[model samples]
Target: MDRKKIVEIISNHYSPLTPECKLDLITNSKLLVLQKGTVLVRGGQFSDKTFFIVNGCARAYYLKDGKDISDWFAFENEFISSINSFFLNIPSPHFIELIEDSVLLEISRGNIEILSNTYHDFERLSKVVAIKTMLKQQERITSMQFHSAEEKYKNLLSIHPDINQRIPLTHIASYINITLETLSRIRKRLTRI
Candidate 1:
């Protein structure tokens, strides 16, 4: 949760930051330690803060009727934010919840605007991060539409093999658009084959 460490991690993702930009981020960002099951962003809430995870994990989900459908997960060294709300200044459609006890560095939207306006490199870095985020979301949507549950599961495992160790089976099943029973069967079959 150290500001220096958080800045260093984020810098690695986009581009090298100027000393002033780093200082501004360090000064504006705040550390939060969230407990498991904590809801950081609720659907329909206006949230302008973005989080950088330093440790542990979180999930973004949408509530349909009474069911919670997980859309994405953020682990250590990942960014988690209500993108629609953060970018458009509207209520969020997703709820972000802490899946494990986590350390996060939070930056407000206003501060991000200031940084982007004052620093050209910061703006470029933000664009790169936004592009990457959009691409990941698009890829997820494509996989969900074109791939079977087992195929999605395998692809997820290939990218994040340790995810099963971090999240519960039920959440993983929901994320991959499969039932818990189906996921269990898939695991059993994979083990046997």
Candidate 2:
């Protein structure tokens, strides 16, 4: 994965970085190529790093009654991390896995702190990312509480049109809190209408 391209993508979403900050990220962060099914963060593991996906996709999940419940997905040009654990400096309850073969730029918490201290733009970018992440989570929770299964599916497609093509139906069903059969029916109904 091209470090410059990855930096550019993140910068587009967050803020423009100085040449020095960009260079620091490129040098301090490690590029990782993960195979599909690779677990980057395991439940109960202390996670100190955040992944910036340069290619492919990943999912964060939790185990509930022996079943994996997918919480969220991160694709290319997005960030993935055990937010609770990373911020609190504790073991994580969520597991992060690569759903497709992925390339990521891994930045440790220490390095992130260093960047935040050294660059004002980096701090602003971090705040923006945190706020965006929280807002997305809140939106998902609100959708589940207020929307029907079909409405949820339609809204998801409206926001992320390529999700059905990229992610497995079962995982999407799990994320939306619907059964696979129900999701299939919804898809069929959507096609006809």
Candidate 3:
């Protein structure tokens, strides 16, 4: 991935980083090409690396009662990490998987800390990322508990307009806290209207 391209993506989320800071970030992070079905972090494992998706998509999910319950998905120019484990230094309750072949910039916790301490811009970016993550979690919890399956599905599309085309129905259903049959019915009903 182009360093400038990645820098531009991050700039969209937080304040623009100085050219020197972007160069430093490029030097500290490693570019990785991951295949679909790749599990970067698994439940009960400790991994503090956060992946910034330069391209493709990934998900964080839990294997609950032998079923994969997707919690969230990240597409191009998004950051996806095992949040609790990465932030709290505990075993992850979820697994991070590449749903599509992905190009990622892997930033380790130590490097992130070093960068944050060294550059004020990185610190600001970290704060913005944390805030966004918290807000997303809050929204998901409230939506799943209060919203109907159709509402939840529609809300998801509002947030990720192209998700239905990119993600599988099973994953979408699970993410919206509905059965696959229900999701199919909702989609069919919406299409007819």
Candidate 4:
């Protein structure tokens, strides 16, 4: 991605970066082109890196008794990281997997800290990112805890209307905490209504 594209993405979510901050990011960040099924961080691994998805999507999932349960999905122009592991310096309970061929900007915590300390605006940028991440997590947890499987799927569609076009039904079923057969039934029922 060029500087202009980076600028546009940053500007879309947060405020436009200052010239120095932009230069620092352009110099420090690495563009990662990863194919589907690429696992960035596995369970029990410590991930100090955070990925900004410029294109495509990634899913955070947990492997429990050999069954993979989807935790969350990050789409284009969103950030994906092993949140607790990245901040707590501990092993991650979830694995971050690229679900599609992705273009990502990878930034290490070291670089983030450097930028946060050197530039005031970078701190603001970090705050904005943190807030957004927290809000997303909050919503996901709330849905998983309180919503029915059908309601969860409906909420997912409301949030990302085109998600079904990009993601597989199995992953969606896992994310919404339903069996694939149940999800199929739910979809059919919704279509009828």
TM-scores for the candidates: 0.96, 0.96, 0.95, 0.95
Which digits, one per residue and each the tens of the lDDT, describe model 1 over residues 1-193? 4888789888887678888888888998899987999999999999999898898899999999999899999888778899999989999999999999999998899998999999887888788878877888898999999999899999999978998899999899999899999999999999899
CA RMSD of all predictions: 1.1, 1.0, 1.2, 1.2
RMSD of model 4, in Å? 1.2
> For residues 1-193, could you state the per-residue lDDT of candidate 2 as single tens digits?
5787788778887788888888888888888987999999999999999998888899999998999899999887778899989999999999999999999999999999999999998888888888878988899999999999998998899988999888899999999999999999999988898
Which pairs clash in model 4? none
Please list the residue runs of candidate 3 whose C-alpha ends up more than 4 Å from where it truly belongs after superposition. Answer: none
Candidate lDDT scores, in order, read 0.90, 0.91, 0.90, 0.90
TM-score of 4: 0.95
Q: Candidate 1: which stretches are off by over 4 Å?
A: none
Worst 10 residues of 3 by lDDT: 11-20
Question: Where is model 1 poorest over a 10-residue stretch in terms of lDDT?
Answer: 124-133
Model 2 lDDT vs. the true structure? 0.91
Count steric clashes of candidate 3. Answer: 0
lDDT at residue 48 of model 3 (Cα atoms): 91
Backbone clashes for every candidate come to 0, 0, 0, 0
Better of 1 and 3 by TM-score: 1
Instruction: Please give, for residues 1-193, the per-residue lDDT of candidate 4 as tens digits.
Output: 7745774687668756788888898788888899998999999999999999888999999999999899889998889999999999999999999989998889999999999999888888888988999999899899999999999999999999999988899999998889999999999999999
- lDDT of candidate 3 over 2-71, digit per residue (tens): 7667876897765677777888898898888989989999999998999989889999999989999999
Error of 3 at 16 (Å): 1.5
